[model samples]
Every structure is written in C-alpha cells, then in structure tokens.
Target: MWSLTMRASTSVAPPGAKTTMTLIWRLGNSWALRGAAPATSRATAAAIRRFIPIIPLPVDGVGRPSLRFIGRNAFQKGPSTVSETENVFRPATPRPAHEGNGMPQSGRTDGPKDPYLLASLHRGLEVLDCFGARNSWSLADLSTHLGESKATIFRVLHTLEQFGYLAKDAATGRYAPGLGLHALGAAAVRHEQLRWQALPPLQDLAESTGETVHVGILHDGVVVTVQIVDGTRAVRMHSAVGKRSPAHASALGKVLMAYLPDGEVDAVIAAQGMARFTERTLTTPGGLREALHRARLDGYAQDEEEIEAGLRCLAAPITDHSGRPTAALAISAPASRMDPARVAALVPQVKATALRISRMLGSPSMAAA
Candidate 1:
C-alpha cells in the first residue's frame, strides 16, 4: 500500500578523473539519507555495502539478512522502536504445508520486501498464472484459485483487459487471454521453428556459394535477421543475427513483401517509408511494385547494391504449412564476387534451399499443386 521511488545520478569528470554517483531513495515525504556522500567510481560497491549495514535489517541466526514484511504496523513504529519490534522483524514460521523448504506455501521465494514490491501487480500476475491451463476464467474462479477477494481480482482483471493482456466477454463477463499473448507466443514459436529448420540449409548454402547467408522475418515493417551463417570467403559480406534492416531495400525483405498480400505490402510501405539506402534502392511505389512482380514471377528477389553500396543479395521465401511466407532465406556477397553471371547461377540454389525449407514446414510443392 506504500509507494517508494528511487533515482540515481552520475557525474563523470574528464578522462582519468574521478566519477561521482548519487543514489536517492525516496519513501513518500521522507528521504532515507538526506545528505549521503557521493560514491566515487571505484568505491561505489563499498559505499553500498557501508549503507546496507545501517539499514536496521533483521538477520537470521546464520548471519544472512532476512527480508520479510510483517505488516503496516511495523512501519508505523519507525526506527527508534526497533528493539520493541524485534519479534515482528523475525521471519514468520513457515506454514505446515511447506515445511521441507523455507519457502512460503506458494513455492515462490519471498521476492522483495513489501515496501518495494507492488502487491497489486503480484496479484495481477497470479491471476494470469491461473490461465495457463484454461482458455477463460470468471472472477469467482480466479478469486478462489488465488485465495484473494473477488473485488481485488475484478480490479486486476479490469486492468489486464484495459492493457489488452486479457479480453472480457461482454455477455458473460468472463475473461480470456487476449490477442497480445497469442501474438507473443506465436512469434516465439515461429522464430524457434524457423531457426531450427533454416540452420542446416543456411550452413550448406554458405559453404556451397561461399557467401554469407541469412534467415530473416518481417516484423513491424522491418526485416529482423533471426539467423546468419558467415561465408568461407575472406572478403564476404558480414551481418549478425538479430540485426534489423529496412524491409523496402533488402533482398530478404523484398522476397517476404513479394509473397505478402498487396494490401499488407502497401501498409508496410506506408508505415515505413521507402528510405533510399543507395543509388539502386527502389524508393518509389511503382518501382517497388514492379520489383515485387519480378520476384513473384522468378520465385526469388534480388538486391543490387540497394541496401548497401558494393553489396549484392538474392533471397527466396520460406512458406509455412498454411502457404504463407513466414520467413526468407538470403545470400549476400561483395559485388565483385557476385557479378551478373554469379548471381544468375546462385539464384536457383537460393530458391532450391528456400523450397526445401518450405517443404520441411509442410508447405505443398508445385508438383503436389
């Protein structure tokens, strides 16, 4: 029920000069340390250690600090009445049900003490934890499961609904996990599957073509590289996993955009304007549309120094079981090594690798079609 705020400020002098850090802990109207000395750069840890001892913390018989909240009455007595509240400060005897371990009945470590922890936030999470085994929950159901009052559970549910973490049925007043949770779970699953399936082919493609290979997915109109295999060539193009690139200018992005619906592609272009990265970058809508048309027809996409000067890339789409382009696999190389003849030769190899990955994902092939 109490609110606590903490802020830290650091002052750095010129190179080789001493740095000073000030930690401010505010509890409502009171400051825990009014004019504590600024901690030097080297002695910050020592300063914190010095401050912790004066905190009047309760330690167990073994000499370790025991952090447990008694009640609001304990805080009301203040620091001067420490001796009188010694019994209140001692760790509460664990319930009979959780006797083996020192942990509470919930099997969770008593997290931070009450003053620093938000009871409401913890209750809200407890409500969410209940939904793991079921599709939906009513207020009474969550209240009983968490052993919290119905009114408290209702407030938590309402807050979760407002944040799109839960959706409430208008007719039944029941709550279920929302689209936000589904989106997060789906993204995690898709990324894991894509990386697992793409790694082998990516490594093979890199070794065969002697060029850097990447597996990327479109997220929020950007190409997020999920996996990468560096080429054997000493001067090959370099890129790292988890790097994000403009979806409009990269081959991996273009291949993904090519397979997506026209409306979605337009939405991406509208949201992330076609910022030119090089002279060859397609900045106009009509030009990009034409390029996508070519990519769709040729079953692959090409980037000729569009994203970065002196670099060339070719990419093909990896489809999911539903036949949707879930990710793209691409090969990148220096322009000198990826001349027109070399690119033409590599195109089929990239497309083949992509098709193999798509089949692994359970997408039907042209022969089946």
Candidate 2:
C-alpha cells in the first residue's frame, strides 16, 4: 500500500497549487494509488514531486514501502491539481535472461508452475516463509518486518485465514499456522515415505529397549525429527515429530554426517556453527571431525550428555536404495540409566533397527563401515 505526504513551500502556489493527497492502499491483491499535488512554482513543485512514487519498495524481502524517484518532467501539471496513477505490483529481484520465463519467480520455487502467476500469491507465500524464522507473528510485526502497509498485510492475513492456512489468536492478535496448514504440511513432507518405512522398526526398538526412539533427517544443517516412539519408561526423553535440533550435538545428526563426503562436514560446520548445548557438546570443527570418524568406524554415534545434561543417545545410519545415508535412527535414555554396559547393549539394537529400515528402502549393501 502507498501513502502520500506533502511538505508545502511557504511560498504561494499558482493560485491552484492547493491540492489534497489520497492514500493508495491495497484492494484485494492489487493497489490503486490516486494522488493530487498542487500546481506550484518550479522549485516548490520539484520539492514535492517526489511524493508520487512509482514502485512499492519491498525491502527485497519481508515488508515494503515506495521510494522510486521520478524525473522532473514525468509529472503533468493542470491548472488545478497534479494527478497520477501509480501501479504497486512489480516483480522480484532481477535475474539473467535465461533464469526465468520473466513472469517473475514466485519466490517459492516449489510452488505451482502456472504461467499466469499472481504477484499477490508470491507475496502471500513470502509471508509463510517468515514463519520459518519464528513461530508466531502479530499483524503489526509482520507489516514492519515485510515493510508493507498494515492494510495490505491484513488483506493477506484475511485471505490466508479464510483458507485455514493461518490461525489468529483473538486474545493476542498474533497468527500461527492452523490445522489446515498442518494437514497440508504433512501431505507435503519429503520424508513421508521414510517415516512410514522406519516406523515399525523404530516402534519395535523402543519396546525392546524401553527407551525413546527417533528417526531424523538432516535439513539445512539441522536434524529434523521425523518419526518417534516414546520409551516405555516413566522418565524418557520428550520429543515431537517436527522438532529440530542442532546437528553436531545429536548422535542422529553426527552419524548421518559421518557418511557425507570429506569436505561436506566442514562445509556444514562453516555454514552452521556448532553451538554447545552442553559442556560435552562438540564446539570445535576438529573435535567434531574426530567424533564423526569414530562414528564411521564403529557403525554408530554416541551422545553422552552432549544434547542434554542427563540424556545419552546412540544412533546408526539408515541408507536408501543407493546405499546413501538419508536418515538416522537413535535411541535415547536418561544418563543414570545408560552406563557403559547399557549403552553397549542399546548400540546393537539401534544399529539393527536402522539396518532393517535401510533394507526396507532397498539398500543393496548397507554393510558395517
């Protein structure tokens, strides 16, 4: 949306320079800004001419305003008021000629591939992307973050809420993902097949070991918990299906990273710094490298109070048909319950369960490495 402000010159106008400015806001997905400035002296007119902006200045990202400088001759001055119509819908970042059909990248590369793509749709999806950084957002916060007007954000929120993609809390005036989004998200997960394939074995392992079990995959240098079977014990690790944790601190993450090509481990370390969750958490790249080496040699990884002060874990890699370590299975228990003997016993169970899942995925040779 667009709003116009006037800084009138104290000098008198050409009798007709007295004009009113109108707010150009969002109407559905489109914007129509109607503006009129007074016809004044060349100096005064030039001073105020900048009030008419050409584009909605979205900060190359979340929110937006308008700040395009027009040439001095772009305005047409009538005897009374200066009138202009500015279009706010514009494409995103410019790309080389070959990168796109030029209809504008939807910002969401995985979204629909329709040729007649709508700018408003891309903007709506960008709103969704912001949630990745934080769980909930207020309308004002989103407007400030995205640099768009509250009116524009409200329309987008209203539309998203109508579709059940976003839920609003009447008490807090903040928005979070709704059940409809959850259903769509579950349907859209790339790990759906992996979760189903690993669930049975994971459940069996949890029952056999009386410890919590989790199957997680690496995403953006973080471990995303995909499948979980709570341990039968009264005091087991608490986890959820979509929880994410730092990679280098978790056994599941370390075991999976152990199978990556030589430099990728360092690359991940460089991209995502290994934050120390506990005193035992690996902080240096060298320490993590050695740990990963041991994970590779032993066919499993261990987390001895690395992720949590009193929780220990052992994880083994689950391979795909190509024998690629696509995921990892881990067993977790309280530190007091998992000493050397207990951990040694659980290691084999976790490995066997992971291997069973690997076999289910048609891994030809997920042999001990």
Candidate 3:
C-alpha cells in the first residue's frame, strides 16, 4: 500500500496569526489507521474534516469510473516481474490504472495481476461498508449489493471473520461487523470536527440539568451518540458514545431524524423495521411519523420512557450553517427528576445551547453571529 502524508506548516509570521490547524493523513496496510499525533487546531485541517476513501480500481474490467476520468482505471496493475516474496515487499512507484471507456479496462491476464488484487481488496472494502450501522448481515444482501459472487463474498467474509473484522450470527446465519472494525471507526471519528464541536454543548447541557447530555448524529438509520457528558449527580446516567438507539426511541435520535426529508425518514424506518421499545414507544410507522411531525412543529422531541423503563428525555436538533439539522443535542434523566414540567423548562435551554453550537458552526439562526 502507498502512504500519502501531507503536513501543513505556517510559512511566515503574519501579524496576530497562528498555525490554526494541521492535517495528518497516514495510509496504513490492511486498510486502517495505525497512529496519530496531537491535535494542533481544528480550524486549519482539511483532511480531518473528512477522510474520503481513495477509490480503488480493479485490474479487470469490474468497476467503472465516471465521465470525468472515463478512461482512467481506478486501480493500476503494473508489469509482472519475477521476484521472490522478500523482494516483492519493497515499495515501488505505483502507476495509475488503465482507462478506455467509462470502465476499468483489463488486459488479458493468465494469472492474478497486481491491479486485480488491489481491485479485489477494494471490492472487499465495499462489502465491509455495507455492514455499517448494523451488527450483522446475511450473505445474500452482501452479494446483491456488491454484485460479487456469493462464493467470493463468503471467502472474504471468512477472512474478515478470522481477522476479527467481522462476526457471524450463529442463530440467524447473518454476518455483522466485529468489534475491531468499530474500534477503528471510533478512532477515526474521534478526529472528526463534529465530535470535538459537540463537547461544549454536551457539557453545558449536563451542567444545566444535572443530567446526562448526549450529542448524537444520524448514522445507519438511527441516532448514535458521538459524544456524551456525564451528569454531576451521584446517581448520574452513563452512556457509551457509540451506543445505537432507534430514531424514535430516544429524544436525541428522533429530533435529528425529524429534520431529514420525509422520504429519507420513511426509508430509514422501512429498512430498520420500527419496533416498539416500550408501551410508550412509537409502535407504528404512522405514529412515529406523527411524532416527527410534532417534533418539527415544536422545534424539539420528547421521549417519555419510550426506551428505558424509567427514563425521560428532551432534544433539539443542531444544524449546520445551511440550517440542515445533521445532529442533535439531548438531555436524559430518570423520570422522577425529569418530569413533564421540568422537561418543558429545560427545552429552551437545550434549544439555546443547540443554537449556540449551530451558530458556532456557521448555522444561519436568529442567534447566529
């Protein structure tokens, strides 16, 4: 694998200016991040904003590129040379893949070409991508999405399973992602802007209500906490950052999902199979839709013991500069303390903090600078 690392440096002294950020892109073998340096500043880094995967091209004409690079193969296979395994370990300048039509052009290969190997690896990545937001998967779904043969996908799955990158559900015969993959993903997101930006609001909400405050983002059709602030109370609540909850079950999740277009919301619900978490939980798709409708009308969402047996929550969406709510801020506490009157009182403060963070992110709001 080729490693491309770009480091930004302040060229010269500009009055009252500082090196605002540094982006570190470390390419690793086996498709993962190995290590990283300390954070300098969040403002200047470009790569940290998002780590877009470098598109992998195949040696054979399997994957195709778009019109902009119509003839360019996403993967380039170099000339095969007779070398020992030890000799093959050395790095060489990688050539771009061949492109003819809008597809990767393959040459007549009697054996496995380097490009084909890389392309196969990339396809395997695509298969891995399919298992996001869920813990398990079925073979048929993986095959259908990747357009790869079941046998090939099974082989890849077996390898990933062995490597602890994937897990097989014994009861359902479905394959879901493993913990190791999640660890890597968690590491990546820790470097993300949204994660860092969420911390202050989370802390503020927690301090204000003396309850657990969570900052969740929509992922894989559900709302998941990207950051959390534990409460000050002795019996304070605790939640893991990556814990997944139904969009309709948690105040945070529903309010964030409510901001999405109706079609998107319906699609997510359809795919996830809206199940009631409690008697108070939204039991039907229609009911969930109505809840979302209410949330939009009131600019907030409420979960009255919808998920946990004795928990109550209130949430407000956090928007970007364009006013698109990509995340939500929520405070959750035991129902005994977070009664309807208390929850109602906290709504304005939660909304204010959300708006504060939104304004910090350049969100267009009455509170924005």
Q: Evaluated with TM-score, which candidate comes out highest?
A: 1
- How well does candidate 1 score on lDDT at residue 277? 88
Put down candidate 3 lDDT per residue, 15-97, tens digits, no spaces. Answer: 43333222122344222221223476775344543553322211112111111111213213221222321232222222233
- Higher-TM-score candidate of 1 and 2: 1
Tens digits of per-residue lDDT, candidate 2, 1-369, equal 233332323444343233333333233323233333446688865554454333212222211212232333332221122223233223333333433443333244333246787879877987888777778999997776666689999999999999999999999999999888898886455368788878898889888888999999998888999999999999999899999988899998899899998788878898899888889999998899999999999999989899889998889999887788889999988999999998887777888888899888778886443
Which candidate would rank higher by lDDT, 1 or 3?
Answer: 1
Counting clashing residue pairs in each candidate, in order, gives 0, 9, 7
Top lDDT model: 1
TM-score for all models, in order of appearance? 0.61, 0.51, 0.51
lDDT by residue (1-369, candidate 1, tens digit) is 554322222332344332222222334533242122445675775765554422344333332233445555655534433455465455542333324443223323244356676767877776776677778988987666555678988889999898888999999989999987788788788789889888998899999888899999999999999999999988988889889999889999998899879999999999999998889999999999999999999889988999899999999998887788889999999999888899889988998898888887778652254
Consecutive 10-residue window with the lowest summed lDDT within model 2: 56-65
For every candidate in turn, the CA RMSD to the true structure comes to 13.3, 18.9, 20.5
Error of 1 at 21 (Å): 18
